[model samples]
Target: MDKSGNMIDKMLTQNGLVYKIPNKVAAKQGPAFLQKQRSGSVAYTQGVAAEQQACHWLEQDGWTVLLRRARTHRGEIDIVASKAAVLCFVEVKKRRSIEEALVSLQPAQQRRLFRAAECLLQKHPYWQYEEMRFDLFVFDNAGKMERLEDILRQM
Candidate 1:
């Protein structure tokens, strides 16, 4: 590999293009899908961008964000934020319209978020003092934001 990396050898004989790619793990990422970094998918990129937009929207509304993409073995929290001593475990949904986004947080995902939040609080005791609630930050395709505050668990 070192001999191949030597520019002198490449300059002497060029049957193919010279490209040396680095082998490094992805930084600041959730676990790789199927153990591979499938980074170019449009849906994944849009979802990430939606989460970032949700963060900005929360900040503008006087919410103090504590964490972005907090993960547990079971699931991930999109944003952990607080305002007026009330901590919110936020789940963000992005869709073609605000109404569509509102309906996107399915019951199964809600359960996962709640379970993840419980696990996270157990590990980090300091947040336990604050009153915790579930919220949904819904965004449309055009980047408009809406809030569904204190989502109730479906019975």
Candidate 2:
């Protein structure tokens, strides 16, 4: 309908209906703000869904999950759980395959997770937990979860 012969688009707003220029122009002219917003929303939702799945699996295994998305200056621990008398700091990595998930936690990530566990211990002095362990939950592309090694003493 415009001079370029492309159909003009309309978007609804609380104020009223308004015309929106085609996305090609803005995407080509400057930063893709809309795309970034959409991508961020998608990533956040995916993370939450994965955490929920991990929590469900942990509960089914008789672990009392205390917290999720636990963050510190070091990094974010996906889930914190207590089983028997031990405290567990968990790192969850989701990938398309077992090999991908195994390789997901690089050396740098391991260091961050280590620091986060120390921070957790510092925060909860009353925990008096006899054992502390770092565990990894690997989720495949189909959303199947499996427990890998408990990399506590390895540190």
Residue 67, candidate 1: C-alpha displacement in angstroms:
1.0
After superposition of all CA atoms, the RMSD between model 1 and the true structure is 9.6
Q: Residue 72's C-alpha lDDT in candidate 1?
A: 97
> Which parts of model 2 are misplaced by more than 4 Å?
1-40, 152-155
Work out candidate 2's RMSD over C-alphas: 5.9
- Residue 71 of model 1: what lDDT? 94
lDDT of 1: 0.78
* lDDT at 89, model 2: 87
Clashes counted in candidate 2 amount to 0
lDDT tens per residue, model 1, 1-155:
13344322222335776664432322223245424556446667888998898888889989888999999998999999988879898888877899998888778888898889888888778774457788887878787888888895635
TM-score each candidate.
0.69, 0.72
Per-residue error for 146 in candidate 2, Å, reads 1.6
The lDDT values for all models are 0.78, 0.78
What TM-score should be assigned to candidate 2? 0.72
